[model samples]
Target: MSVNIDLEITVTGPLDAEQAERIADALNDVAQDEGIQHDISFVVDEWEGRIEVVGGTEYPLIITRFGQWQPTFESRVHGAVQAVALAAKADIKWGYPDDED
Candidate 1:
């Protein structure tokens, strides 16, 4: 049996190559610890932003912070999202079985 955790996390706003790599590293590190081999990817946009914490403190208004967990039809997706959500303190948005379209 293969265990893989696939979750969607958004890191928005203008990003340079370095910032993207760091984001990948952090997500990978978390996934590895949970026995999941997966990656975090983002599609950047002008207004989309993610809050960044450097040296563990001080956030730039330019950066935005977000955490979301959506339950899919797949069981594996559920596991991954749940695991990732548990690892963070920020509030997470969980998709509902009856989400308003």
Candidate 2:
């Protein structure tokens, strides 16, 4: 059976280019370690030095994949994101749909 997981990571910032690359690298590492194939994509907007209320004050980076994954994959991904967030001094919000949903 195949499973498709849709993942989104929202970074609240004023992030510099280097910081953004670090986050992307961390997430990619997770995908590599899991031995899962992923087509990664990102959305970035110029930080205006102020949060915009219209979009909940965050920049979103999204990842999507359809394939088999190990049972511990999600946890590992979360940890990687968290570590990157801490180092980058940015806040992160992420989620994936429940398997049953």
Candidate 3:
């Protein structure tokens, strides 16, 4: 095949301050793993920080972000992934069809 494919990954969610920090770290790893050479794109967008309800019911710290990937190089990040130590396990969404649906 003379055509090339663009590999991309995006991350987004609502999480606490700590969780958001961890997620951000994880996203960096993901981006490094995918590699810019492979046209990989990564991004994190923070949406909700705090939500309030009636009776002064304030919600915890909430954050939402997104990561996109597209490798411009070859062979991924070549094992030189930028990972963080002692970080929470981030939930990865692979865009797989909902089997339960």
**CA-RMSD of model 2:** 7.7
Show how many residue pairs clash in every candidate, following the order shown. Answer: 5, 0, 25
Who wins the TM-score comparison?
A: 2
4 Cα displacement, candidate 3 (Å): 6.8
Candidate 3 lDDT, 1-101, residue by residue in tens:
12222223333333345544544455455455533222333334444653111010022111122122212221232222223222223222222122224
Q: Write the per-residue lDDT of candidate 1 for residues 13-100, one digit (tens) a residue.
A: 3445455445445544544553433333222223335442121112111111212222222233334334434332222222322223
List where candidate 2 sits over 4 angstroms from the true fold.
41-71, 87-101
In angstroms, the error of model 1 at 29 is 0.9
Q: Which scores better on lDDT, 1 or 3?
A: 1
User: Considering summed lDDT, which 10 consecutive residues are worst modelled in model 1?
Assistant: 55-64
TM-scores for the candidates: 0.33, 0.44, 0.31
Best lDDT goes to which candidate?
2
lDDT of 3 at 68: 25
**Candidate 3 TM-score, C-alpha based:** 0.31
TM-score order of candidates, best first? 2, 1, 3
In model 2, the Cα lDDT at residue 58 comes to: 28
